[model samples]
Target: MTHRRRPNDRLRTLLKEADWTQEALARAVNTLGAEIGCPLRYDRTAVAHWLSGTRPRHPVPQLAAEALSRRIGRPVTPEAAGFPVPWREPAGEDPVTGFAALCRSDAETGSRLVLQQRPYRVADARAPSPPALPEIPAQRPAADRDPASPGPPQAGAGGPELAALHDAARFFAASIDTHGGRHARSALSTYLADDVTPLLTAPRPSPSRREMLGAAARLAFLLGRMYEDGQLHGLAQRYYTYAHRLASEGGDRATWSLVIRAMSAQAQRLGHLSSALQMGDAAARAAQGLAPSQQSYVQAQFAVILAQTGERRGALSALATAERAAEHAACGQGGSPFDTYPRAALLFQTSQVLEALGDLPGAIGALRRSAAERAEADVRGRTLTHARFGQMLLRTGRLDEACAAWRRFLSGRERLRSGDAERALREMRRALRPYRNRRCAAELLALSVPLTEHS
Candidate 1:
């Protein structure tokens, strides 16, 4: 059979421009991948495959472009590598079916082979995002929902109401903070399949339809959060995308902005700072007409991106705006049942910005305040705060104080399932490496064994 697809002419041209052979290019790509901690062991054979139009998965394509760009002394993109840009999925498609299918597959197969690469956090220049969804639907009159339905809604008369579905989601959300996502992910997934998905398609009177949409929208967001907590970033991204569309369908502008902002958060996790910044800016704009609480949340998120990008002035400005919005929002609705951004949340965010800006003392002060008043249910959040505080202390040569903070974090065994917790433990060991022979270091290392096991 004749090979008919276009050869990677662009890649070939770039290789010639850089004065390199296929083997040379493969070595460069693998070298760059290792530097970034991605183990892309592409050989000359792999390069031959790509040149024949076989697409490489994510960061490899990205890594290849970077390698060529550096070699040629010019910017190179995945498109320039004769590869489709990494992860150019149509963004505006209805994500429910895809999202639900993924949830079920993960739950059943126990193997997430479909998510071969983590979703890209930021948009690329090649393919455009899907056409934007229209304005949020107008809120219609809603029946007072019954918030106590323990089971899936019944089909007809006197059936469990939409409010119960919403409430059940809320119950799971409440447990997530204290118990960690791994602790509750199975139950949340089951709820999504059994309780939430059914009501989403269940026939409802037009009057009660608004409430159902709202409940489903919230459930999608909560599921996304749970996925994030469990470090399943790709799945979280999908759920957030679906939730945003659902919010638009229901005219839930408040949550629509939050969901968009959530995608930004996931992008930040993936270290796509610029992409996260773009998402945050868009979310802040979309949230302008929303409640102060919503504005507060987005502003803090924008600050995080700014901080990561080294925009100190911009970050501080956004942080102040977030504080003002948080105050105003506190005077109003106080919190969303779907997510929270209390004072402690703001303080923790401030520490991150300050830390990024190299104000270690200022970061420590903010973290101390955050830890002092963190909410009880925010177990993972508090654990992170403790870990950060400890890391900072250890970095500053205050070993004993750092040990205290690590102890505080380790005490929360329930939160150990999170990747963040594991990183914190690693940081502690690395920090204590110099004093490895010290009694305190040995004690600290011993206490962290259980953490390593869980992590």
Candidate 2:
């Protein structure tokens, strides 16, 4: 027997506040769905059903929340609209199996799984880590392979697969750096679900199994980065958690540290200071006994967290430790991209610390150095740097220079597919609104309007 449903007063209240008809809300959701490549034919009837407590599928609730958010000029979460949060990681699931499911979901739905999900709150982050996985198990039968698994293992088991994964990781990393995370993200997810999952379950020697786990962890980390770039922080956090597990199982503490550091950064970006500090401290601890460059990378992130929390002395100490480590790190080392910590990244972290400490000029100086040191091929990084630099200049009353920096950001953003860049464009518009009459602001606004029309 079916149970009776209660009316969704939360959604009704939001609709009343926005003064939007059911048809208008449905149309908005449909429009957003189409933009994200998930076309829909939702109408007033479907919306009425939602109001009557008939929950829609995978992304409709999310789409509805986002549509409302845009109209209301603030965040409208799924929970705010009386809908359960979409695509949450299941409780106490096996890490490997859960990760496979996540990959398949991402591959099948593209960005639909993440496009409307908000960053998880700090309270949600307190859940215990997944328990340590048992040793790699023997291969299952061909008939036992899941949808995400390949039919069977290829002829060359260990070395070849690992090498290919490494190559794919590097290629995707470079692609993300140059073109931004939206570039080939679907393809990458598909590769992980369809190609990589098989090797993960394939029978192998102990050493070979560990190596495969490490390689897979790196790919997962890259996928997490892509999600993070899209500003899908909750989805990114899931990926990072899985990657950390993979690294830990593979006996790869360095990769584990990197993943943890990534989590800390995500928390910091979301303004969860205590959680960020906790994760930052953990990441630094994990980085112990790692190489100088890797240690420096972890330390620098910790320094940013410290500065944000008013721990000036601790921040300075951490920064100095990072500096010494970087000075000792040899450039041009051949290893995983995660293994190398470039000067540009360190300087960017330095800029963040200074900005947190309320030193605008010092932050600007550090950011300029970062921009200068950035590799020419790193278009996404350079664009983001310029965007940050523009914001910094704007804060210092340097309107002309801010506009100049933003011009550079727009120039590079043309080739990028980053959500961060998109947000930066919106921020620029807001910052320049007060100075719209100024020649620099007007000229820049005119230039940027066409670029962000559909954003």
Candidate 3:
């Protein structure tokens, strides 16, 4: 059921920037696709289709972007390479690009609600069930850059000299948590490609080399996070793979384990249950004898993946271990959340796992803890947590309480930029469709109306 995708101006702009003819671009896409074992025998006619709004399938767009990125000597995402999801951005530096791009969508939804002036239909026992979350595409790990290629800027970085890189990554990461990833992700990606990559390849003393490696790993991890926050799953997976390789080579086992755990979470999120379990197991094994907090963090990831894989007994057992370890780490122990992951992140993962296991009340309890554990710097995350909780409550028939949770979500206007939040709101509205006449449902709709219309 592939809908015809609309043509976009983005590709034309990219072609001008790359100085490539349509035929050449199409050839490049075919070549890249062949390299990845996905033979797309596209030609100029294919390119014409693309230009005429015929959006190609998933990895084809990614391959085309990579082909262009290689030609331009800069990272070119699918959006940049002329394949954005038909959400045309309003012109010029509009910070709220996501909202603007979907303004017409909002308008259409409003019009579809034809009873604006009349009493709307209320809840019906057989009203359509809320749609299940869509299956997110599993991200494929990309090959690392060829060592011979001198990225964009001259590739000469020292070890200790990279402390600034680490600091900058940390700062931007914090900024992303506070301001959302829309604008900041590109900034960080540019910095990584232009400044850090070269420095990473430069000569350095042993100690400085180790320092540089650590910084590189951290920056790469944050880069992955930025991509993930932006919903660029393929790019995020590649960046995470780079970070994992860096950590492994640098003997940063702690970081390596953390990366593995993070990979597991991403895999699970994208519905690769078996791969998630394997990655989680690797993380748990790698963290053996590490600080209780770090081990606790790894085990927590293990529990979630285990539950996802239907290993109920093992999941619960792992969770218990994580609990005890977390408590021990909290008692002035060696487990710093900064060095590993936040102790409360486990709780958030746990809530999802519990929900998967059909423990409704238990999931709510974990969600509450997860909300409380979010750092103040994590503005968007807190909002997401509340929104998810509200959705869960709505599903479980707690309309008033769900509204209360959604109110908290609606309050975080500035920090809520990820389109995931928007989609979650859409789902919430769908759930409310049946109960439209209820006071709480009406209130929820009123609150969200402005978000879509004016975000």
For each candidate, the alpha-carbon lDDT, in order, equals 0.68, 0.79, 0.64
Best-performing candidate as measured by lDDT: 2
Ranking by TM-score: 2, 1, 3
Give the range of the ten consecutive residues with the poorest summed lDDT in model 3.
Answer: 118-127
Q: Order of candidates by lDDT, top first?
A: 2, 1, 3
lDDT (Cα, tens digit) per residue for candidate 2, span 1-455: 12236888999999999999999999988766643445589889988888888888767777788778767867778889988763544678766777788788788776545533533434434222422323333654534432211112334546678888888988999999999987898899899999998888888887678768878888999998998887666567778888888877776676777788888888888767887888888888767656778889999999999999999999999999999989888664445686578899899999999998898889999999999999998999889999999999999899999999999999999999998898789899999999999998999889988888644
Candidate 2 regions with alpha-carbon error over 4 angstroms? 1-4, 7-89, 110-157
TM-score: model 1 vs. ground truth: 0.74
Instruction: Identify the leading candidate in terms of TM-score.
Output: 2
Clashes of 1: 1
Q: What is the lDDT of residue 213 in candidate 1?
A: 60
* Per-model TM against the reference: 0.74, 0.78, 0.65
Which residue pairs clash in candidate 2? none
Candidate 3 has a TM-score of 0.65
The lDDT, on a scale of 0 to 1, for candidate 1 is: 0.68
lDDT of 1 at 435: 80
User: Over the stretch 256-348, how does candidate 3's per-residue lDDT look in tens digits?
Assistant: 667777777777775557667878888887777556677888899899888878889999989998888788777644212234456557788
